[model samples]
Target: MKMWFLGTGAGRPNKHRNVTAIALQLPEPETGWWLFDCGEATQHQLMYVPLKLSKLEKIFITHLHGDHLYGLPGLLSSRSFDGGVTPLAVYGPIGLKAYIDTVFSLTETALDYEIVIHELEEEKQGIIYEDGRLRVEAGPLVHRVPCFGYRVEESDTTGPLLADKARALGVRSGPLFGKLKAGEAVTLEDGTVITPESVTDGVLRGRIVTVLGDTSPCEMAVLLGKNADLIVHEATFAAGLEEKAHEFGHSTTIEAARTAQLAGAKQVALTHFSGRYSNDELSQLVAEATAVFPHAIAATDLSMVKIDRVHERRAGQDEISS
Candidate 1:
C-alpha cells in the first residue's frame, strides 16, 4: 500500500501546493485508489500521477470546508465525461447528500455511475468500509463542524511456506507440500504425519495507516492512530502560530509530530500546510516537527510514501525445538 499526496496546502491553493486531497492506493484484490478530501483542482493534480478516474472507487470527506470539498462536483462531472462506469461510494458528514444534490441541480450535470453518500455522525466508530483486502474505519475528529479521521488497515496475509524445509523433513515436491503450506496436516505413504507447524511459519503482519482530517490534537486521533505504520496528520501551522491552528480547529506541525510519537506510529507525514508559508518556511516547519519527532516529514504534492512490509518466514526446526 502507498499514499500519494494529491494536494497538501491547508486553507487555499498555492503555487507550490494545491489544496487538501490524498490518494490511498492499495494492490489487488483491493486494486485502485480511494481519495480523501477533494479540494479544488484535484483532477488537475491527478494528471501528475498514473491514476485513472474510473479506478477512483471511494471518497471520504473530512468536513464541509470549501478547501476540503470544492473539487467534488468538478471531479464527479469529469468522471462521467471520461467514461467511468464503476459506482463510487462517498462517505462524509451530514449535509453531503444535500450539498451534492444542490450542486448538481444548479449545474444541470449528471453522472453516469451510481454515487452513494454515507453521512457519518460522532456516535459511530467502527468499520466503515470492508472489501476483499481493505478494512477502513472512521472516528470523530475535533473540528468546528462534524469531522472524521480514517484508519485503513490491510487484511493479514500468510506468505509462502518453506519448500526446502518441507523437503528436508522427507516431504516430497508434490501436493503434500501444498497442503502443509496451507496449514493442513498430511499423512505420507510411510504413515508419517506432518503438521503445518512443522513446515510453515505463523501469520504475517499487515500494514496499518491512519489519516487525520482537519482536527486539533485530540485523544480520539491518538487512539485511532495507535501502533500505526504511518500517521498522516494535518499540520496547518507552525508552533509559533499554534493559536491560529487552535482557532481554526487545525494542528500545528509540532502537535502532529507529537501525536504520532504518542500513538507509537513508526513514521509520521505532516501535511495540509497553510499556503501562506513559503517553501523555506514549510521546511523550517518540518524542522520544528522533526525536533519533536524525528520520523516526521512534511509531505509534498504527488509524493508517495512506501510502507515497510513484514513477512513471516519459517524458523529452523532445531530453533523451533530449542
Candidate 2:
C-alpha cells in the first residue's frame, strides 16, 4: 500500500498545498486506488502521481465540507470519460449521497458505471466496508460538522509452507501436501500425523491505517488510530495556536502527535497545514510532531508513503508467535 497526497492545505489552496485529498494505491485484488477526500481541483493534482481515474474502486468522504468534496463531481465525470467502467463505491456521512445525487441531477451528467453510495447516520460507528481483503470502519470525529475518521484494516495472510521440510519427511507431492499447506493436519498412509505448525513459517500481520478529516483532538480519532501502522491526522496550526485551532474545530501539530502517541500508532503523517505557514514554518510543525512521536513526519503534496508491515514468525513447537 502507498499513500499519495494530492492536496494538504486547510481552508483553501495555496501554491504549496491544495485543500484535502489523498490517494491510497493498494496491491492485488484491489484495482487502481482509493481516494480519501476529493477536495477542489484534486483531479488536476493527479498529474503528479501515477494513479488513473479509471482504476479508482472506492471513495471515502470524511465529511461534506467543501474542501473535502467539491472536486468529487468533476472527478466522477472525468473518470467516466477516461474509461472508468468499474463500479465505484462511495462511503460517507448522511449528506454525502444527497450531495452527489443533487450534483449529478443538476448537471444532468451520466457515467459509464454505477455508483453505490453508503451513507452513515449521525455519529454512526462500525464497519462500513468489508470484503475478503479489506475492512474499513467509520468513527465520528470532533468537528463543527459531523465529520468522520476511517480505519482501514487489511486481512492477514498465511505464511508459506515449508516444502523442503515436508519432502524431507517423505511427504510426497499429492493431496496430503495441499492439506498441510492449508494449515490442516494430515494422516499419511504410515499413520503419522503432520500439522501445519510443523510446516508453516509465519503469519503475515495485516496493515492498519487511519485517515481523519478536519477535527480537533478527540477520543474518536484516538479510537480509530489505535495500533494503526500509520495515522494521517491534521496539523492545521502550529503548537501555540491551539486555542484558535480549537475554535475552528481543528488540531495543532502537537495535538496530532499526542493523538498518535495515545493511540500507540507506529507512525504518523501530519497534514492539512495552514496556508499561512511557508516551507520553514511547516518544518516547525513536523518538528513538534516528531518530538512526541519519533516516527511522525510532515507529509507533502505528491509524496508517497507506505504502511509498516508486521509479520509473525511461527515460534516454538508449543506456541506460534511473530
Candidate 3:
C-alpha cells in the first residue's frame, strides 16, 4: 500500500500548493486508486503524478467547501471523456448526491460508467468498504459540515503461503496447497491431513493508513488513527494561527502532530496547508510538528509514501513483519 498527496494546500490554491486531495493506492486485484477531497484543478494536478483519472475507483469528499469539491464535477465529467469504463462510487456527507445530480443534469453530461453515491449524515464509525486485501473505515470528524476521516487498513491476516514449508511438509502443487494457503485444513494424497497452522508461518502482516480530512483536534480522530503506519492529517495553520484553524474547524501543525503522537502512529504527515505560508514558512511549520512528533513531515503536492513493512513488538517479543 502507498499514499500520494495530490494537493495539500488548505482552503484555496497557491503557486506552490493546491487544496485538499489525496490518492490511496492499494494492491493489485483492487489495484485502482481511491481519492479523497478533489480540490479545484485536481485533474490538472494528476499530470504531476503517474495517475490515471480512469483508474479512480472511489472518491471521498471531506466537506462541501468549494476548495474541497470544486473539482468533482469536472473530474467526473472528464472520466467519461477519458474512456473510464469501470463503475465509480462516491462517499460523502449529505447534499453531495444533490450536488452531483444538479451538475450532471444541468450539463447533460452522460457517463460511460455507473456512479454510485453514498451520502452520510449520522455520526458513523465502521467498516465502510472491504475488498479482500484492503478494508476502509470511516469516522466522524469535527468539521464545519458533516465531514469524515477515513482509515484504510490493510488486512494483515492474509498471510502468504509458505511454499517451502508446505513442500517440506509433503504438500504439492494442487488444490490441497491452495486450500492450506487460504487457512484451511487439507488432506494430502497420502491421506495425511495437515492444518494451515502446521505448515504456514501462522502470522499475518499488512499495513495500516489513516487519513483525516479538514478537522479540528478531536478524540475520535486520535482513536481511529491508533498505531497506524501512516497518519495523514490536515495542518492548515501554524501555531500562531490556532484561532484561524479553530474558527474554520481546521487543525494547526502542533495539534495534528500531537494527535499522531497520542494515536501511537509510526509516521505522521501534515498536509492541507494554508496558502499564506511560503516554502520556507512551510518548512518552519513542519519543524513545529516535528517538535511534537519526530516522525512528522509536511507533505507537498505529488508526494508519495510507500509502506515497506511494519514491525510491532514489545521489548521481550520476537522480531516480525518483515
Pairwise lDDT winner, candidates 1 and 2: 2
Instruction: Report lDDT per candidate.
Output: 0.86, 0.88, 0.85
Q: Write the per-residue lDDT of candidate 3 for residues 3-73, one digit (tens) a residue.
A: 88889888789898888889887665565898999999999888888778889999988778898899999
Error at 55, model 3, angstroms: 1.7
Error of 1 at 240 (Å): 2.4
Per-residue lDDT of candidate 2, residues 1-322 (tens digit): 8889899888889888898999989865465789999999999999889899999999999988999999999999999989999899998888898898899999999999999998888787899889867899999999999999999999887677888998777788889778886668888778988877787777767889899999999999999999998899999999999999999999999999999999999989999998999766777788888888888888888888976456577665333333
Greater-TM-score candidate between 1 and 2:
2
Clashing pairs in model 1? none
My TM-score estimates for the predictions, one after another, are 0.89, 0.92, 0.92
Give candidates' CA RMSD values in order: 3.8, 2.9, 2.4
- 218, model 2: CA deviation in Å? 1.0
The candidate, 1 or 3, that scores higher on TM-score is 3
Residue 225 alpha-carbon offset, candidate 2, angstroms: 0.6
